[model samples]
Target: MPSLYSAPVYWNEQQYLLSFYDPFTFRLTISLYIAGISLIPSACSAPGCISNYYPDDRVHIFRVPENPPELKQAWIRALHCDNIDRLKVVNVCIKHFREEDVEYIHKVPNGDGTFTSVPRYKLKLKGGAIPCLLPGCPSYYSSTSTSKRARLSYEPKEKEMLNQTIQLLSKI
Candidate 1:
């Protein structure tokens, strides 16, 4: 009544009866399973997009927004024209938040007199803060309640490229 993997006698008997053991297939299957398991943590939980590669500089996966729906809507509006599917995976980069909205972790001395802090500086953004009005990011700036004419209005193009990249990632 033992399982196939738990019963070594069964495996030996099967190998003896077949006179062959496909170790390569077994190992390949095991390695594939392990690799798939390793990717689970990186999988995007966004509704429509299932991307796994979120580059550090370009994509900052903020903590999922609160339940009120205003935060998500604001992010979408700030990022400019949006489809629900694109909004599903919309994440803001550090550029989107005002400097004041983000909290910086300070260096402090530990009890033994050793300074302990993040190896690299990290900023924590508050949950309710909306995306900031960046001067050059047309998507953000124009979306803001500001003047329409921007000398450097290239964010629409950037959004297109970002969309293309996301589409490519999803296909992969």
Candidate 2:
């Protein structure tokens, strides 16, 4: 009978060395790198918004609130995105909200009876805040009025009453 072992193995062709290398560590490292990059949350979640997160910029990004299903749904509707999963993790930039909706100061109650207004370093959305100003979206989507509508004409009796009031005021 012939000996059982006889053939010469080619290391390069067979990748004998690579077999010893653990791919799990390499794959884990790559996965970790990608996760780290995604942790920054640099982009806005609002549809058609071009705003990005910058440390030095005045533009502030607010996380989408998960609680209050109605509020969250309103935000989703305003953003024009139906992806609830994506909205759960994404943020909306300040540009999407009205100026009044962005709370620059917070009223903190002191130990005494007085309430102090503390200026916030980080911008926050007021309660029930919803994005209304979407400049990047179509005119129909934005809450901003594109054109001024003409005032309704007063009725004859109303105009006569107004004239009488004006005349009475002029006499006084």
Candidate 3:
């Protein structure tokens, strides 16, 4: 017995069927599927930012907050993104935030009214934090300084006051 479907016949039939569709569109669709390109968008939302979400990358992506209108506006302005009245599903990467704004430890409360500071494996934004270190943007967008300032000591003032008090007591 002979096979009903032959290879030449099958290929000819496929080519004939494909001729009805636009070649560019069909080839593009097939190539995209074969290339395994993701349909989901996973890039940082900041303007000019090229960071993308990857499992192995140390960079962390954070969702833009929708609540607290002030914070949302601040993030939008700092990022230099416009016309984003609704920031749903928008993500900002860790590169846009200052070192102090990102929290790396979690304070777990103990039953005995004490707290233990446990290091966190994932990064989190501190409360009232804003994204101010936008790279590839105007320098004014990152107006805040990154350098930590040295704290002035009050020990000299305290020592002078103590000496004055001691002298007063001795005279009395």
Candidate 4:
């Protein structure tokens, strides 16, 4: 019949009720409920919508990644290993695709248990084309097949890491 938050009730922050004068049979009822619960979780008293974590103070994602088993984990690893800690993850390119991302990264082992840390620059949405198209380079370089020329041009540090990997591959 009537809501429970129509009167001047202070259940949370930014929440106050407004009631009207009802003089039919001498009974008081609530008119409506309003508040800024959406901004603060602690102020939320709705059914199944309150928790210890505050929505406003949550970890804001600087970037979101595509579907992958280890999306943020991979990027976090990259950030922790080298001097490229300022670049935040704006997007995920997907499994094996991020290798071509413009970020200067090195997939080196952190030696902290069994994880690898890779660091690189922010991924650019365009201008990523494989470079191994030159005459001197063969169609496949030691099994990698192709290398992102853009990676070499834009992120030499990353390219050098790749080169090192290629060198190891060639020896085996």
| Cα distance off (Å), candidate 4, residue 79 | 1.7
Ranking by lDDT: 3, 2, 1, 4
Residues 1-172, candidate 3: write the lDDT tens digits.
2223221212332231111223432321111111233333356888777675332343677888777665666677767777655645688888888788889889999999999999988779976577777777888777575331111124446788999999999999
The candidates, ranked best first by TM-score, are 3, 2, 1, 4
Task: Please give me the total number of clashing residue pairs in predicted model 1.
Answer: 0
Show pairs that collide, candidate 2.
none
Runs in model 2 deviating more than 4 A are: 1-41, 53-58, 83-88, 144-172
Off by over 4 Å in 3: 1-41, 53-58, 85-88, 145-172
Per-residue lDDT for 1-172 in model 2, tens only? 2223333334454232111222433321111113224433356877777565332333578887778665666677777777756433778888887777788988899998789999998888777677777888787777643121111122445779999999999999
Residues 70-158, model 4: lDDT tens digits: 44333334323243244433322222223443445546666676656476443332233221211222333212343333333456577
Which residue ranges in model 4 land beyond 4 Å of their true spot? 1-62, 81-172
TM-score, cand. 1: 0.37
- Superposed by TM-score, candidate 3 places the C-alpha of residue 127 at a distance from the truth, in angstroms, of 1.8
Q: Estimate each model's TM-score.
A: 0.37, 0.54, 0.54, 0.16
Predicted structure 3, TM vs. truth: 0.54
Instruction: Assess each prediction's global lDDT (C-alpha) against the native.
Output: 0.45, 0.61, 0.62, 0.37
